[model samples]
Target: MKILIIDDEAKAQSLLKKLIADLSLKVDQLFTANNLLEGIDIIKKEAPKIVFLDIEMPEYSGLEILDHIDLEQYPFKIIFTTAYQQYATEAFKLSAVDYLLKPIDPDELEIAINKALKIIEQNRLSSQIKSLQNALNELKVKKIALEVPHGIIFAEPDEILYFEADGMYTNVILKDQRKRLICKPLKHFVEQLSQNKFFFKPHRSYLINLNYMTEFIKKDGDYILLDNTIHIPISRSRKDDFTALLRETFL
Candidate 1:
C-alpha cells in the first residue's frame, strides 16, 4: 500500500516515518508533503492508498485539499494525525474512520494500517462495482440518534434494519430486531437518510432495507412483501423509483 504524510512538522514526520519502517509496514510506496497544496499534488501524482492527513496547515488545511471533490479521485483511506483534539469528533462523525492524536501511537498506526488493508482488500474484491459502491458509501448518513422508551440510543448506519413511518413518528428498526422511535418525523428522517445504504420507500409508510431484503414479491393484493410475509404497499408516486433502485441493486 502506498502511504502519504501531510504535515509541516519535520520531527513528527520523521518519527512517523521511523515507526512506519520499524513496524515493517506493508507500504509499497511512501510520499511526504509539508502542506495541503503539496499534499494534493502528491495525492494526484502518486495516488497512494492511505493518507496521514493533518487538519491544520499553512495557507490551506487538509479538508480544503478536498474543497472541490472529484469523487473518482479519492480511493485512498485517510487516518487523520493531528495535535488538535477539537477535530477528532468531526472526523469520527464523517465515518467510523480512525483518528490519531500526536505524538502518534505505534499501536494506533498499526490499527489504522490494518483498517486500510481491509479496505484495500474490499476494493480489490469489489473492483467490478467499486465506482457505484464508493459513491453510495459517501452518501451514508452520519450517526443517527433515536429516542427509545428509556432515554435515547445512538444508531450507527450499519445497525439499521429498516425504517417505518408510524403516523407522525418514524421507527428505526435495528439489525437485532429492536425498534427505536426517532424524535423526527418520517419526512425528516427520509431526507436525512437520503444516501449510502439501499433504503427505499416502496410505500409511503415504509422504508425497506435493501440489505435485509430476503425477497420482494407480490403478496396480498398490491402489497409488496419485504420477506415472505412482511407486506408494505407501494405508493403510486414512489413505485417507479423504487422499482428502478431494486433493479439496479439486483440486476
Candidate 2:
C-alpha cells in the first residue's frame, strides 16, 4: 500500500513518517508534500492509495484539494489530521472518513489505517469519497452512504423509518416499506444521526426517526407506532425521556 502525507509543518510530517515507519505498516511508498499544490502534483504522479491530509495549510486548506480531484477517476482514502477539535463533526460527516487530532495518538492512527485498508479492499472507496464530498458541501438535509452486499446506497435521514440492530449489522427501514441490511452497527447510526432532532434511540437495538412516527402508545410497555404500523419498543430506562422529547417536539 502507498501512503502520502500532506502537511505544511516539517515537524508534523516527520512525526507521521516516523510513526508509520515504527509501526511497520505495509507501505510500499511514503510520500510527503508541504503544500496543497505539491500534494496535488504528487497525487497525480504517484497515485497513492491513502492520504494523511492536514486541514490548515499556507496557500490552501486541505478541504479545498477535494475540489480539484476527480474522485471517480482517482479514488483515495483520506484521514484528516487537524489541531482543531471543532472540525471533528465535519470530518465525520463523510462516510467511512476519520480524523486524528494533532500530536496524533498511535492507537488511533493504527485503527484509522486498518479501517481505510479494509474499506479500500472492499472496493467501497469511490462511493465513500463521493459521500464525503457531498457531506462537506451540503448541510440542509444530510445523506448517509450505507454499504450493502453489492455496493453503496445513499439515503436521506427523513426517508428512513428506523434502524434495527442485527448483530454486527443494522437493518434500515425506509418510508417506502423497503428494508436494507447495511454493514454497520445500529450504534454507528445513532452516533452519526443523533445530532439531528428527528432521530432518537429509544432502545439499545433501535434508532427511530421521529419524523416517521405516527403514535406513541404507553399501554403495552411504552412502544411507539411508526408510519407503516411498525411498533418499536421503548426501553424502560428511555421511556421517560422519549415521552418528554415527543411532548416537546409534537405536543
Candidate 3:
C-alpha cells in the first residue's frame, strides 16, 4: 500500500509523515510532493493508493491536481487535510474518503487510513472519482454512490424517502418503502444530500427528502409524514425554520 502526502509546508508534511509512521499503517512506501505539479507527476508515475492532500497550497489548490490526472487510469483515494472548515463541504462533494482537520489527530488519521484501505480493497475508486469530478464541475449529480459491506449501491436522490439513524449506521428508506442499512452515519448523508434542495435535516436522527413529504403533523413534537407512511420528527429548535422553508418552497 503506497501512501503519498502532498503539501507545500515542510512542517505539515513532516508532522503527517511522523504521525503515519508512529501509527504503523500498512504503508509499503511513503512519498511526498511539495506542490501540485510535482504531486501530479508523482501520481502519474508512482500511482499511490492513498493521497493525503492539502486543500490549500501556495501555487495551486490541491483540487486542481485532479484536473491534470486521469483518475480512471490511476485511481486513488483522497483524504483532504485542511485548516479551515469552509472547505469541508466541498471536500465531501468530491467524494473524498475522509477530511481531517489539521494539526492532525492520530485517532482521526488512523480512521481515515482504515477507510481508504477499505475503499481500495473494494475497488470503487473509479466510480467515486467520477462522482467527484461531476461535483467539481458543478454538474447535476443525480445518483448517490454508497459503500455497503458487500459492494457499492448507486441510488438516485429522488428514490430516497428519508434516513433514520441507527447507532453507528443509517437506515435508508426508499420511495418504495424498502430499507437499506449503510455503515455511514446520518450526518454523512446530510452533507452528501446538501446540494439537493429537497433533503432537509429537521432532527438529529433523521434526514427527510421534502419531495416525499406528504404532511407536516404538528402533534407529538412536530413530525413529518412521508409518502411511505414513515414519520420523522422535527426538532423543537429547527421546527420554525423547517416550517418556514416548507412554506417558502411548497406553499
What C-alpha lDDT do the candidate models reach, one value each?
0.76, 0.87, 0.87
Over the stretch 58-100, how does candidate 1's per-residue lDDT look in tens digits?
8877665557345366767778888889988877654525798
Off by over 4 Å in 3: 124-251
Q: Over 4 Å off in model 1, which ranges? A: 93-96, 129-251
* Model 3 agreement with the true structure over 30-125: per-residue lDDT tens digits: 999998888888888988999999989987997676678877888899999989888988888777999999999999999999998898877767
- Each prediction's TM-score against the native? 0.49, 0.48, 0.49
Per residue, candidate 2 scores C-alpha lDDT tens digits across 139-191 of 63478888999999999888899999999999998889999999998888887
Show model 2 residue runs off by greater than 4 Å: 94-96, 124-251
Give the candidates in order of lDDT, highest first: 2, 3, 1
Worst 10 residues of 2 by lDDT: 88-97
Clashes of 2: 0
**Any idea what lDDT model 3 has?**
0.87
Clashes of 1: 0
